[model samples]
Target: MIKVVKRKGKYLVRQGHTRFHGLKLAISEGANIPKLSVILIDYKNEIEEYLENLDGNRSNGLNPVGQAHALAHAVSLGYSVEELAMRYQRSTTAIRNMLKILDMPLELQRLISLNLIKKTLAIEIMLKYSNDHKMVLKHIEGFLPGVKNIETTTSKIVGIPEHNAAGAGPDTLNKGGPEKKNSAVTRKTLGIKRLSHKKTERLKSEFLELVESTHTESITNTQTELKFGRDSAHLFKNVNSNNVIFSNDGVQIILNDEKLNILLSLLNDENTAIIVSKPKLEELLEIRDLLKEY
Candidate 1:
């Protein structure tokens, strides 16, 4: 499809330049192509035009980094997530998911762009690990598909006999009961006890570090608070008790229709000293007027 823009009193090709050129080449060779499709779009400014141009170019899809960049650029151009969703023909949730990619560490982004980490895997890392760059990277490093397969195959290759090679049956290997016997058998067959205690302690330490790092680094960044978790739990405790919180996005309240009507009824009382920001007040006033219309 060709998107044309009005320029110099003529409809000019704004998108699908390659397709246009291909058609032109076909025409030059006397190939009969009677059908053509075109779409005309109007934009008030160059930024809008450029944004559409960028959208047109993304029909083939983008890598995770490019997706994040595009979403970020659209936001920088004063587009809301809802607006971007409409423009891109996507759900607001999808647009928000793309925006989340921007909050990831640069190293993770590089890995994603390089395709060393799949986008689905990266998203899994983000959701499971949150904002811990080191832990995410470490997990990626230790994700050995081939080695895991080999280990499983090797275990099957070394078949288990009625008695172990050391002449120890399940009953003889563990006197601690069935669970213990199973555990003992697994340990003996896998030779897990051969790993040094020092190495085990080191692994435990690294795991604790990963957990601590995830906690510390995650809390300091307000992105999660802005996204999934509401910010300042202690500070907003009182506000939450009222079942509502005012934010830059506007007021979000947990109220039934009856409760909302009761609150609206209270709005007309002379003693109610409601304090709200200008934008919020405007929204409330609009709502009040809208209620009158109903």
Candidate 2:
């Protein structure tokens, strides 16, 4: 039933907008809305309470911008975090995040209202570049190539150039290939001791072995499951969670089957998150030394 307040011979709808719109559509289609029901209200007394409750009872299915506006209105009406959270059926943290959406740059708000960008991405831009709406738009244009006139930042891709990625052409490599003659010279110029080829190879091999031994899914934002392997049990043990997985927390490499990509997950936040202390600190230093030398 539609609830409305009658004032000066006109009605102001306070709820059931969907039903009212449906009645309009039905009327336009030459169909009967004979069973329409509405509750009358005393405009002077109930309107304020009705409006307040309306803002607080916003449906979660509303658009992100609508949700933000409704939540913001609730906050402005002296609604506490706990009250808003309960009314919105969300956590207090989620309510805070919703309110934060209004504080984002105006350009971001527009994009969100138009559904061009997501709420989370908008918040990320807001956090990164407070009010730099130009930069935020430029960054957003990168992920959405179809959006025209955004003047994307066009950052240079940091990898092998397409022409050199694979080359059988003449300019690719001269007869002796690139020279390592200057490699040892450059090391000497930096006052660093250069290892012999045999020693370097041995060190590299050992470094790889150590990396494999220390490989674990205990690293942050990374987890692995044994899809199918004969030695899956041992693999799982090496990669499983442990309060003290290593003597020192560092970057751990996680290999995934998707595109055979190797992911480097930082395990650096040791003091509070991951318990990282043991008698095997020397091995970790050995890994560090090999990394430094290489």
Candidate 3:
């Protein structure tokens, strides 16, 4: 029986001193020799489970599955796939795709496990250019954080930036004002405005539908009230209510005494308009008319 024992930060057999001494001498001469551990596990079932776990399931002993799993695991643990694959004799493409699973934000991975995203699509996204991949991942993370399968996630990610995806000139697409004017002129010359209004209306309908489809709870609301009351005087009072009072502005004001004072100070400013409910469409149209007049 080989007696396994620990000595000088290494595991060695007591009967194999000659071999151990040779290894120690090699280490002393600056050769890199790995330290070893000798564990005497008593549970047969536990040992079998461990053996099964370590088994690569390779028929021809190439162990591609084991290598792939190892590459994936190493990437998840923060080891760069390029470095590990270089050392382990695996293709960089395989390593990279494996690492992409690790690159998925934790929240997205949970969705993926739940079948929200397809595996093929996720792998495709992982293989995209770094910047494009990151942008797609960010959009997905924001909108469909709990998405599980690949198809849905891919569709959502691609759709978010579809406008930018058109190989149209970047300046024409992104730059506003004068550049947009030039582009419009060019479009008119090329007779590209054939379905312009129809396209605009379609986009408008799509935007409205998208907004309507979203959960209302995701939207936030803020209310502001303006009172036209005199100093220390109760403005408008409701007939049926005692504590609840109305303001002369035809709205209920629910401000503390201090806030009321600040609001009064702002009300006195000539340049300010008390905008209510995001400025009505009529008000916007009037502004446009005034601009046209100018």
Q: How many residue pairs clash (N, CA or C atoms closer than 3 angstroms) in each of the candidate models, in the order given? A: 0, 0, 11
Q: Candidate 2: misplaced stretches above 4 Å? A: 8-10, 21-36, 41-61, 129-138, 141-294
lDDT per residue as tens, model 1, 1-294: 898887778886667877998998998999999977899888776557756666565444456666666567667767788988898797676676667767776655544554445554455465556457767555554542221122212211121112223221111111111121111112233222556878866765664454333211222322211212345434555663455566664445565554444456578856343345655544443333322332
Cα-lDDT of candidate 3 = 0.40
- What is the lDDT, from 0 to 100, of the residue 248 in candidate 2? 32
Identify the runs in model 1 with alpha carbons over 4 angstroms from their true place: 6-12, 27-40, 114-116, 144-294
Better of 2 and 3 by TM-score: 2
**Candidate 3: where are CA atoms >4 Å away?**
1-90, 126-134, 137-294
Model 3, residue 189: distance off in Å is 37
User: How does candidate 2 score on lDDT?
Assistant: 0.48
The candidate scoring highest on lDDT is 1
Candidate 3's residue-wise lDDT over 159-209, tens digit each? Answer: 111111211101111111111111111223323344677786686566455
| Residue range 1-294, candidate 2, lDDT tens digits | 677666568875656666788899989999976676888855333324433435433432445655666556555656677977786587676776677776765545544544555676565455555446677556655554423332212221111111111111111111121122211112233233779999988987886765555444433444453242433334445555542133232323334443122322233343222233443544454344434433
lDDT of each: 0.52, 0.48, 0.40
